[model samples]
Target: MKDVLPYFLFFIFVENVLDLFFEEDLSWNDSFTSVATGIVSKTWDLLLAGSFIAAFEYAGTCYMWNNYRLLDYATDNKLASFLCFLMVDIAFYIDHRLTHEVSILWLGHVQHHSAEKFNLIGNLRLSFLKIYRTWTYLIPMGLVFPPQMLFFHLQANNIYQFFLHCKYVPKLGPIEWIFNTPSHHRVHHARNPKYIDMNYGGVLIIWDRILGTFVEEDEECFYGLVHPVNSNDPTWIQLHYIYDMYLKWKQQTTWSHKFQSLLKGPGWRPGSPRLGFIAEIPEPVKGDSKTRIDPPVASSLNLYVVVHCVMVIGSVFVFMTKYEKDNTNKVLALYLLLCYLSITILGRIYDRKKYAYGVELFRLLFLVAFTWTNEGSMVQFLRSICVASSGFMITKIMEPPESILVRA
Candidate 1:
């Protein structure tokens, strides 16, 4: 699986390129943000994979029922694989549904749905905190299956889910009834009243059908949260909902009400104008008004940002592949810093913030200083040159018109 990581990345990149360039189904900023978030999520996954595996091993060894331990039985029996897969699918369905229904859980799950555009890149917009809670859901399965089997099946489920984020695939005639396809999963991502909280299955759709949580694709799906995130900042995308819940908790007059605000469904609030379950549908906002800032930027600047983002992403891949256990802390810190600076600078650029160029300059200077202290590789020098030149171009292009500047 480690060896095949590049292939997986390539497949996702190709799909995104086809969708953005050929299909024209996504916006440049939306796609860029989604891809950036996905890259950040993958970076965290690489940094934390060892810790999660250790935790899983410990839990499975200590927590399983003695007589019910199915490791030997499952290993010897070919049928056990299918049974274990079924168990994981069911576990994911329940966990995914609960995340939507419980406000606290929603805090960790909301980032995955914050994107207004549905594309393969959106699949990468996962929450970092999700690693902590998602393992808990698999603990029950640990009671039966071994930790190894549980981990394998969990990855299988997720890999199947990756391809489900696209809009290119239409409803498969018979397969749609059994497996969770692109069409069915689209309903899960939508905020439409008819589609909200439906189709929670990871690999199988039968759980949703049997449980009466399934809704067939009908009306055009509007992708995103009830209230659009409207910003491309990855930090804000992950934390805004948690902050909103905290604020809501603060507004409560009593402790119990405060707990309710934190634990209740997203629609729940205190007092009059309380919304019923079905009536909690979000009022539609005009699409044009969804974006808060849209300053005109040169096409060359936009292309530069995209190219620089790709370079950062490739650098991350190289770092992860060559990362060593001995220097794990140093490598992880530098990698995360690079990714953070890249995304933050790109987000500021997309919003046309006047300070974007300044931040980009600072980031380039930091990179140069860091390189100078090390080997001062030619690759680093060339990258710094490209980034600085692009930043200068963007700064000049985004300058206000002379008349507006004079009035100010």
Candidate 2:
């Protein structure tokens, strides 16, 4: 996982450049939010080495060890391997569908759809809360395939899905009929009334076609949720929908409606069907009249945030590569604290909050204090950069510059 982190970072960099060349409307703030969320989620996963295996593989290993195998054949066989892969894809289809259809589950998934611009970084914008939920659907498949094979196929399915998040790809004529293409997935991400809850397949569109959830890409997609999360804060992005659901649950007068508010589809009303009535879904407002939640940011602030974010990412790499496993709890906890603080400060800066400057000063002070005692070349380097950045921020704040301190 540590080795592959750099590659994912590179992919985001490449996508950013590509979007720039294509003159695509891109939001660096949203992209940073995705990266920050991923850093926390993936870093935690790395901290717990067994996190990649997670519940799905653990259950599969237990079942396989007990000789409760369904297939009873090794994955070395080509046909068997293909079959196992197919089963995993089917598992993803079921898991993906449930996340969309169930209201409570959608809260765990809403962050992925919260990105107004559909881009590759959007793939990294996954919910940490949604990570463990897949085992519920994938565990049953464990009866057939071994844990290793299940892990491999799941990763492959994810890799395939990652490419599906891009915008430049046009509809492939032949592949569109069977496999989940970029076009198919754009519909999946869209909040358009016609496209909502459609194309839930991970790698294969056949499951959705047969199951009747598939919708063809006929028009340009208006990406993101109908009710957008108008903030870039990773913490808020993760919690907003869950809080929204809680409010929805409280609004219901009857006990059954309260429970149903959570269990039913996101758009469900008192008299709607299990997945809600389509007629009730409003036709999405389109074109220039519709705007995304992007606040204007000064170029200098963009450079500041970008440079520090790269350092935050470098800190994760340094911890992973240099630090030992033993006696890491204290160090890891502090690292996590700085990470969250960094994310919050950066997010607030992008959102143009009045308190962001104060929070930035606090975070810099916190970093200075931690790095003062810590040993290592990387630690020293980080301390120097933090000090320099702090000095720069202080100068700007003292100026009371319109771009830095005084804002709308």
Q: Which of the numbered candidates is closest to the native, going by highest TM-score?
A: 2
Q: lDDT tens string, model 1, 52-143?
A: 65466457544773446655573546687789899889988988888888889888899999888777778768887677777666665666
52-72: candidate 2 lDDT, tens digit per residue = 657445765667635777666
Model 1: how far is 157 from its true place, Å?
0.5
Name the regions of candidate 2 deviating beyond 4 angstroms. 1-6, 43-56, 59-66, 277-290, 322-328, 373-377, 395-408
Clashing pairs in 2: none
Regions of model 1 farther than 4 Å from truth? 1-4, 20-25, 43-76, 271-276, 283-296, 373-381, 384-387, 390-398, 401-408
Per model, state how many residue pairs clash: 0, 0
True-structure lDDT of candidate 1 = 0.73
Question: Listing every candidate in turn, what is its Cα RMSD in Å to the true structure after a full C-alpha superposition?
Answer: 4.0, 3.0
If candidate 1 were superposed on the true structure by all CA atoms, what would the RMSD be?
Answer: 4.0
